[model samples]
Target: MCSLAPHPFLSLSKPFTKRTLISLRNVIRDSALNKPGILADSSASPSRDAAVLIPFCNVNDVPGILFEVRGKTLRSHSGEISFPGGRIDSTDKSFLAGALRETREELGISPNRVEVLGELGPTEVNLRGNMRVWPYVAFVHGHQINEKGTLDTPLSSIDLEDVWKHRSLEEVASVFHLPLQALASPVRLKASKFRGGWPYWAVDVSDLVEAEKVEHGDGEFVDEVGCGQEGRIEIWGLTGWYLSLLTRILQIHS
Candidate 1:
């Protein structure tokens, strides 16, 4: 694996502080609110509106991001790794509300457990190139206050393997946590045939996790995985592009 530039979060000798979180939030907020072009193009209207949550948390006093693997049985983007979100529903109040609602539906995670920070910006996808995806940043609370107003155990204290035991099998295959430091120095790969003729950069995180075999069909198994406890996950396409932007932001601020 080729090494990229050193990540500030990993280089730091001390753990992240409230100041670090503030700076990161400021960066995302400024990028989302100030950069109008990043949000959308007024001349061309989007065919569909969607939103996603870039959920992060403090694990063992270190910063980490959460990702979900789409179920292989799903019709669209099956077995792919992505953030916990979906298209905005009619009953939703706003894009933010839709994102949080989808998170709950996807992972059984309560919307109340997430502390909304800001958005990263919007991105377009699909063959017709009409789907608009809005990415938001939020911090996950360690402990969730119960519906009856009772305090529960910290979520971070739960075992990683058991995190997805209760998730909807029809939507999510598994959930995984990746350290911010590891993502900071991801290996870069190229793909020339992604989404038709569009060229794109793919982030290779093979070194970060153990590889597992997956059965495709007809007794054939592929040594590939998703961003979870045990598997080889390939983070590419629009998601990779968004992560590229995040790495740049972190590098600049670091």
Candidate 2:
């Protein structure tokens, strides 16, 4: 299990001040307003459509973002840290519903507990350049944190130890929270380049006990390739791209 610790510089005692929430809402609104125009060109006739929820929660009053480590046995994106979501199902009424449904299936979090803030726009993932991902900003309500600054013992009505014991084990290995303040901090973000000279951003997670070395698709481990804290547990690819957009919004609003 990964240790859930606040960044050294963040004071958990005072997390989401009124001003912070206001700023966050403002950012979400601005993104929603500007998304359509920004994505109109690239999003046309996308090969695939999917949605992901960027869930914000106040744990011990500290604002953090929820992420799931995909189960190793999964066929796609195994052992990767990602936002809770998946491809749109035929029965899904809307992208929002699909995102929420996937969240519930992956993390056992009820959609009622998530307060949708707004959409952050659609973006194309680098994986084969075929998938389009619509991201939604949301706040998770009623979930509490313990004195240790971790999720309350029985998260989403089940004990922490039993998180992987559920049927979601086929998709999710474990769930974890990363402090939004830490991600928004300049010191924690590093600038890098991706294939074809594309600009990329990554968060430093070297201090995290859960950070592990990433293995390539060929079953070979690359020591210094992917983006992550010190090249380990790379948060690169589409996940890194989405988080980069989030950190940018936070920086502007901060």
Q: CA RMSD for every model?
A: 5.7, 7.4
Q: What TM-score does candidate 2 reach? A: 0.72
Task: State the local distance difference test value for candidate 2.
Answer: 0.62
Winning model by TM-score? 1
Residue 174 CA error for candidate 2 (Å)?
A: 2.3
Q: Give stretches of model 2 more than 4 Å off.
A: 1-13, 17-22, 39-45, 143-167, 185-187, 194-197, 209-231, 252-254
Error of 2 at 183 (Å): 1.6
For each candidate, what TM-score against the reference? Answer: 0.75, 0.72
Worst 10 residues of 2 by lDDT: 145-154
Clashes of each: 1, 0
Q: Please give the CA lDDT of all the candidate structures.
A: 0.63, 0.62
Scored by lDDT, the top model is 1
Under the 3 Å rule for N, CA and C atoms, how many clashes does model 1 have?
Answer: 1
Please give, for residues 40-115, the per-residue lDDT of candidate 1 as tens digits.
3344566888888988765665567777778778887877778889889799999899999998898877887777
